[model samples]
Target: MSRFRYSFQKIVDLKTNEKTQAEWILSSAVNDLRVEEDQLSDLKHHKSEVQETLVSAAANRTTVSELMLYQKYLDHIDHQILNKNAAVRAAQINVEDKQSNLTAKMREEKVWSKAREKAKLHFTAALLKKDQEALDEMSVSRHKQPS
Candidate 1:
């Protein structure tokens, strides 16, 4: 048997809260992903600055106390950077999950649309066939001798 192929012909007819929610979810997910990426960029820039500071401190051969203070500052910056990176990663994961859900929703919508089109076509063809059958019967009866 040949595999069935389907396509949408009346996607415009569907109106439901689910479709509206899907659109909103997709838009929000995209916006959230963008914001997370921007935060990551800012965090990396800050981390780079801290690294530069550490490198300069090392090169200067500062006194022990000053070096210790610099090390503490560097450590604090590193912690903040790590925290920022973690937050960004978590946000990215959330965005990816939401995107996956959105993709599934879109697929569902496509399938539903195709099914609806097929149903419409099937009903229309059936009605046409019924009308044709009726016309054929009427013509045969009209020409037949009384019986």
Candidate 2:
């Protein structure tokens, strides 16, 4: 029997490749989001520490000049935390977009794969029908032979 050849094998391969590439993209985006979140956490932790220091300074006989400096440093850290929070939000949005793209690619690949399977099934049936016809022809030929 002849080998079954898919006419759109290239398309199927391309679709599979696209899906793999999308997975990689989504993975990278997720990693970026994680980094952003870790940075945000670090900033929040630093802000808390600064607040503690400022409070401690207020309880001690700290110089007024030094107290002002602590307040300024606290303000700086608070600003940084705000900026980091924005960065984290942007990274989250990017991850969501990548996730959607990956989903779309997966769907396209599944469609092509299903089409290929159906084509293979049809090819198999045709091959079986042709073989049966050949066998029937041989049987008719044998029955017509002179006894």
Q: Please, what are the lDDT tens digits per residue for candidate 1 over residues 8-115?
A: 434533533456676787788778777877876877787688777767887887777877887787787777778777877877787788777767777777678767
The backbone clash count of each candidate, in order, is 0, 0
lDDT values for all models: 0.72, 0.93
Full-model lDDT, candidate 1: 0.72
What lDDT, from 0 to 1, does candidate 2 have? 0.93
Residue pairs clashing, model 1:
none
Model 2: per-residue Cα lDDT over 1-147, one tens digit each: 899899999999999999999999999999999999999899889889988998998999999999999999988988898898899899999999999999999999999999999999999999999999999999999999988
Worst 10 residues of 2 by lDDT: 42-51
